[model samples]
Target: MKKLAKACLLITAVLFAAPKVHAQISIGVTISANVAPPALPVYVQPACPTDGYLWVPGYWAYDNDSEDYYWVPGVWVAPPTPGYLWTPAYWGYAGGVYGFHAGYWGRHVGFYGGINYGYGYGGVGFGGGAWSGNTFRYNTAVVNVNTTVVHNTYVDKTVIVNNNVTVNNHNSFNGPGGVTAQPRPEEMAAMKEQHVPATSQQQSHERTASQDKSQFASVNHGKPNNAAMNKVGGSHFTPNGQKAPRNNNNNANNNAANNGHQNNDAAKQPNVQQDGHANNNAMKTTDAEKQDQQPAQQQQHVQQQQHNQQQQHVQQQQHNQQQQHSQQQHKQPQQQHKSAPKPHTEQKHEK
Candidate 1:
């Protein structure tokens, strides 16, 4: 009993010591192989018109057994008690492994491991600031919903904050496999305060077995690392004789199509040159292959015809060169080759 209690204390201490360790869940490096995270359940908060309540965004959580990540969308949330603010859930990295911890209501907002939650949660700090008083003016661009959901205050559709959002579907080591950011001292202090886990509606009811499983199958295709998934993301040829560029870098995988265009431009010249060389070689090799398949008489005839054609082309080239040389010769001054010799010998002939 004492040993079990010691183990429990050690585990508790570990969790408290590194709050950022929770953000990471087990995920594979191959993007195509990455299972689509389950969609989080949506819940509505009872309206707190007193002026300090804030909305937390939903996000996808990773599941271990099924090997997939689940999506949990953000929601409208009430403060812990009164003066405390809500720190949005974010993924952070500690000692090379990423951990995911839920965001909660706190006395003051602290560092959130630079996680850019969609709809105005920039990587560093929450785009949504604290309540100045009983009035919190939401960024009109970021939050979206039926006007019915939010009634006590203003709703500006024009104010959007998730404009610079990226789909973070890389499944890479630093980015997705493990978490990479840690919380600051202030954030650690906030961890001990009272907070609420995702509410029932906030809980995504996504079932691994029941929900559509088609999306997970597509993530790992043609991905470089997973040899098994390579067949999925197969080599896609561009229109008009262009092939995708083969890059071994992670960034290239994310932006392969764009990089393919650049590579295609440079590849055009080489492809043309290669085609010319190939055609020349093909023409040469075809005669031999054809000869092997033909009757002896037919082969002789074909060889004779080819030889004649080659000779004719060579003669034509020579003729053209002669014409060019003649033209050049005419442009030069004329010379009297026999005049000087004639003068010496003509003394007898002229008389």
Candidate 2:
């Protein structure tokens, strides 16, 4: 009887431990850090790469080796099986530690800690699209789709306006000081359903993100350069919704070279203008000096002409005086001669 009671107790304990172990395995809790994750980065969702692909919103994933958080960029991926929807991973605070809960795929969207991932996540359920029979239809008002490529799309803005979807806040975790939300009834029901772990492609995509330094929150400061991708390995996009160039380094170098050339040209233009201005100023100064000296030159010429005229007048006056003196002397001599001859002739006449 004693052996049987021990055996029963052992069986009960095993039965109780089995579900807890299974729950841990399903949730895939790897690490719990002392710090909280950074806020979710705001970025535009890339267009669905092809039909049947769903949008997996970006999240902050913790890395134990580096002791930092890295952003797993949002991507459009095909489901592991038909009718499976992706429930995004989120950080949750418990027991004074922030724990990471890995995401999985299930028939319905489950609890995502009300993180307001945006792009139709809306903090409650996925309003981006729905599985219609086997073909996934997109809500154009919430998600981006190329109508030319993807034909099964519809516009529904009511999901955004009417629903109490909390999108303004960017809190990254759930608990105190973060998103304080309890899972809704539907979310609780969905959580009990069968779940499939992340596919190999999703795992590889995260691994790739973990290696890139730019995706780390400490380095990027919550703004990662590569925020989204069209597919797992397809085109990368920036935070501003611009496509990330494959040759980003080369493009930057080219831009720098072009800017340098432009700056050199601009610098040269100012120097040329200054030189021309200086030459004009020099010419103006020469003209001004010539204008100032013209009157002095004219005055000196007039003084020289007046001196020559005065000298000519003096010479003429001296010639006139000498001629007058010679005439007077000749006349005096004639008078003397006449007087002496007349005295001698008169004495002869009287006798």
Candidate 3:
């Protein structure tokens, strides 16, 4: 009886120790919760801030102390090594409990509970970008990248059309009410391959997010203020979904202020040119006014000449009338002399 009890005790100890050994071998942390995490928040991915940065989608992480789930914002980060891809974290429901499977870095993307975290994580595999010989190339069709900043890019719309990638659903887990996806053969192989855990920067990012109360699902109602970041410790989203200004360095702030001044000066240049055009228009208006006055001056001179000619004609008419009156007076005196001569002739005839 003693021998049989020893064997049973050995078997029991091995069984109890198996889980710990498996956990140690696993690449990521495992967490279980009684409730499901909130649905994935809808947000636009920040543009790739620089080349060689891979995108990590945002997900809900649980806090045991607060008994609430908090959001870890999506971010861009450099991989631990080249030729590695990120398999995002996800929640899986099994045996009436939700299990959290944390993310990891591997040569190929593994199954992520089929939860569609947008920007190339289309529920099955990562189609957002790929690496070509240590340089990561971004897919502009699904991923947002600043073309001026990131030069390595390509367009593949067929991936979305062929896979029927649905980004509108906000499901946060896999099981009864969430995504119903089974792992493909390739994903299974990827799961068995060697993996690297999240980087230190990624761990710090999650830790910082956990401390912020506003990131909790209970407070934000599944909508976190900082949904995605351009880079770790770089610009992140605000409450309004716009990127908050970078306050990490004073030099950046000064540069932004200087750029603002330059933009203001550039804006003012147009107004100055407009003022110059207005002055030219005023000068042209003055010239037009002078031209108008020239016509008026010529008309006034013509009117003055016509008045003078009328006065001269009136004087000539007066002179002619006075001469005619004098002639009449001289004719009256001649008539009187003829009458006197006729009277003398009549007296001679009577003698």
Candidate 4:
């Protein structure tokens, strides 16, 4: 009796640890970090249209380990069948951090944090059409019609987003202190229903190509195409949302090369200053030699003034360095010294 009780408790714990499944909907908690946000890149669609497909909007995702965000571009996807609707993906703030909830298929267009996926998927809900009987009529403004791919369904572009246009702006992409929206009853019901996970083709189409990886910020775990998720260290889901160490081998290499260049630049600074010093000294010596050891009164005064000015400039440079270096805990001291002006008594005596 005691063994059976222990066995039952273990099974119950395992079930609870598993991700929640409503109908076909399976949501998993992922461990990621507070990362620097990524810039939004322009996402353009191919001029031509493919039939029997729906559009999914692009978004920026945070990668915890890398401490960076990567943009996920929107693309055209075929509906599961003739009747299913696409639920746009959205992120919700929970426990003082944002949690990403991917879009899923449902009987109706569900709430997705009011993310406007472009076309007719504005913040409120899907403006796209629904299925009736054996036909599906999509809002042409939002969907491309290639009579070839979808024959039974026809769209009137005249009634759609005029000129097949989509709008994206701050007003639509809500930021801090912006509008807050929640899913409606119908949308919530769909979310509760068993979800059908995104298809393999859909998953494949969403990946970032290897060559294009550099274009995005490091940290996104999903391949967005080849693999459902990156199996690298710190890629798995954790409760605290702490991510593992980032794989910055490439970044480190680049940084090393950059450091080398900076050092080369520093090495040349003194050479440049020394060259200027040498040129000034040569000009003075040349003038003195040309005069055949006789000091021209006006020339002597001018040379003295120029020399003083150079000394003052060097002093100012040193002063600036001192001010900047004072805040640092460890910094190399400046080695170069400037020549000082001769005292008035010495100058008069020489005259």
State each candidate's clash count: 48, 0, 0, 9
Against the true structure, candidate 2 reaches a TM-score of 0.62
The 0-to-1 C-alpha lDDT of every candidate, in the order given, reads: 0.42, 0.74, 0.75, 0.47
- Give the Cα RMSD of candidate 1: 21.1
lDDT for each residue of candidate 3 in 200-270, tens digit (9 for 90 to 100): 99998887776565567776788877788888878887534598654333332232232221222222243
RMSD of 3: 22.4
Lowest lDDT 10-residue stretch of candidate 1: 223-232
Off by over 4 Å in 1: 1-54, 75-84, 93-97, 132-136, 145-182, 204-351
The candidate with the higher lDDT, 1 or 2, is: 2
- lDDT, candidate 2, residue 245? 68
Q: What's the candidate order when arranged by decreasing lDDT?
A: 3, 2, 4, 1
Tens digits of per-residue lDDT for model 2, 121-143:
88787888898888888888888
In terms of lDDT, the best-performing candidate is 3
Off by over 4 Å in 2: 1-28, 161-166, 246-351
Tens-digit per-residue lDDT, 146-261, candidate 1: 34544434544432334443223322222434325555666555555556544443342222111322212223232211111111123322212134343334232222232221
Where model 3 places Cα greater than 4 Å from the true spot, the runs are 1-29, 161-166, 238-241, 245-351
Pick by lDDT: 2 or 4, better one: 2
